[model samples]
Target: MEKVFKVLIFTDLDGSLLHRDTFKFDEIKDYLKLLISKGIFIIPCTSKTEREILEFNHELGLNLPFICENGAAISGLELLNIDLPKELILSREKDDLLNIFKNKVPINLQNKCKWVFEMDKKKQSLVFGLEDKKLKMALNRKYTIPFIFEGTKNDRNELSRIIKKDNLYLQEGGRVINLTDRVSKAKALRIFVRFFKKNNKNVKTIAVGDNYNDLDMLKTTDFPCLVFNDKFTLDEIPIDNLITTNKPSPEGWADVIKMALVKIDKN
Candidate 1:
């Protein structure tokens, strides 16, 4: 394969690319598509389910590869290379993770978690800030369980520590907390990079995100971009060349991305 510079964009969706509340990106739709047309990959590295990510791809009218379920799986890799798999499972099944939590996590800690899937459709929609097909798709999680942690800060810290003992971890996204195996966006990104770099020698990653779930991924990329997330403090996830934008997502996404590309070109 010819070795031309390749930029792989690993972006979170909520609070990063899509509007945090509305889940729309119409403002940057053309910009995203334009980047794709120019051969830049806009890969969603999000805590969302595969079905929800597919809806995103469908809306974009593009068949882009995505890292889903907080990196529980990587799908659409066949788009990158002929020999690569159509889907790669990176974490254990959702039930297995849930079983561990049920048996291991203390009853008090468990009670503090309101599992999203166990909720009625109406409540699920309310917690996720999604409705109709989008809500349905979001619930189709295969490798992770989404839930709301109704615990105090100290209780949450204790729960995080306990889960790590069993090799289960939490991914706190913009909307909810996800329980899963010892998988993360960074691990999935590394796997994708390893597979993609096999034939393609020139690959520079640009990671965009807005929440705790996306921190490690941001650190791993050539250019890291954080969309305006006032709730998150930047000092905690600091890294060199960390690009940021003042506006919120749907617009901040495009802004930081453009900044990253300019830096990529200059490098």
Candidate 2:
């Protein structure tokens, strides 16, 4: 490719671009302002909800594109042109998932772990208490719904088969299988890139993340950076065109990314 002034930096939120929690790094605001001043667009791609994305965007004073629900939705930039819904993993009603694993899945999994649980006993379906880490691990591997099961060794194959047969899309994530009938981040990015290319054909694509969920987006970008955050093991995964950080969180990320972008431009 070619060096250019226009660039799109897509980053994951937790364990990649920010602290483990929602806390912002002290220098993040300044770094973001610097990038904005340079005319480089910074977009957040996260597994969070639309409402959460909107709130953060408002806080950051950015009217840029947002990839929410783990790449299920993409919007904001005029040239981005992609927004897809995620599979609707219903959280209310008698969780068929709970009943499906009644024999082996622990009943106290909810109490013992830091994962989101489905509480469908009320009139509406809703997800509750997703801050637990242990539960997040369990649900990350195998998530089940009334009609689908994911996270086995043959998860992709099974999901593909289900999609062919039932016209459904399976869910995949860092800490849980969402079981949504929506689109994946990789697929969504392609859509965005097509539109982005239509306007700025010379723009450089940069992606930063810290988990398995980010693999697709990382592969799709021109430059892929892995934030050396504590929550993830960056060395365990293999990727091409990756930039590892000396520090963690967005503060560390900001320091390195700024330097790298400057170096790339200098050369």
Candidate 3:
């Protein structure tokens, strides 16, 4: 008899599973539930804060573990009674990262970027399209600082050099550019995949995303999917099992997942 394989899925929330502009997953909610019912684990690997991802999990009624703040930290595994290594947390402390940004980047160039936290409630809402409560949740980040760069190409290059000199990095997501220490979605995904494989040796990993930040994670999985995003194109990836969705957001998410489920059933 053929051995049955356990499937684990890692997904980027914004611009992949949820509508990029509205941030709603209603279109694929039922399908997501169906995947969960079939014992397929869906892990949200995103740049969202813990609070925001937790809220999303609560809304979806999924108790799965999640990677947050661009792989700065992983949480919710305690519910599964799984003990993860402390070193799995890859980013530096939030305050330290912010301080590095302030001290490294020149004040003149810094003036061109708007730090999300320093903005007032209304301005924050205007920039992020979130209301007061949601904006508050987004601000509760522990490891990464999101900002909008309002400078020219040369200014951005200068800022990048300044940040690199301080041992920090920048990740461009669908909405904002994040400043973080040495942490990435790929690093966190590897940790989780190893943990999962220890229990189920036949586990196959699937990863889906829509932006540059998702590149590493997508490349790390057995099955890689790139969801369509009108605002940005994916960087060149050299994976053979890669798939691209024709539509965007919840529609594209549902399509790819359904296809994966069918292929798994066949196997």
Candidate 2 residue runs with Cα over 4 Å from true position: 1-4, 79-117, 120-172, 234-237
Q: What is candidate 3's lDDT per residue for 33-113, written digit by digit as tens? A: 988888888889999998998799888987778999999987765543456543357778989988878887778998988
- Model 1 clash count equals 0
User: Which candidate, 1 or 3, would have the higher lDDT against the true structure?
Assistant: 1
Which tens-of-lDDT digit does each residue in 1-267 have in candidate 1? 544699999999998999988889999999998999899988999998888988899999998899999999999888989899999998999988899888988898999999999999899989998889888889888998989999999999999999899899888887788898999999999999999999788899999998788889999889999999888877754688899989889899999989998988887
> Which candidate ranks first by TM-score, i.e. highest?
1
- CA-lDDT, candidates in order: 0.91, 0.59, 0.84
* TM per candidate: 0.96, 0.67, 0.92
Residue pairs in collision within model 3: none
User: Which sequence of candidate numbers ranks them by TM-score, best first?
Assistant: 1, 3, 2
**Backbone clash count, each prediction separately:** 0, 7, 0
Candidate number with greatest lDDT = 1
The segments of candidate 1 whose C-alpha lies over 4 angstroms from its true place after superposition are: 1-3
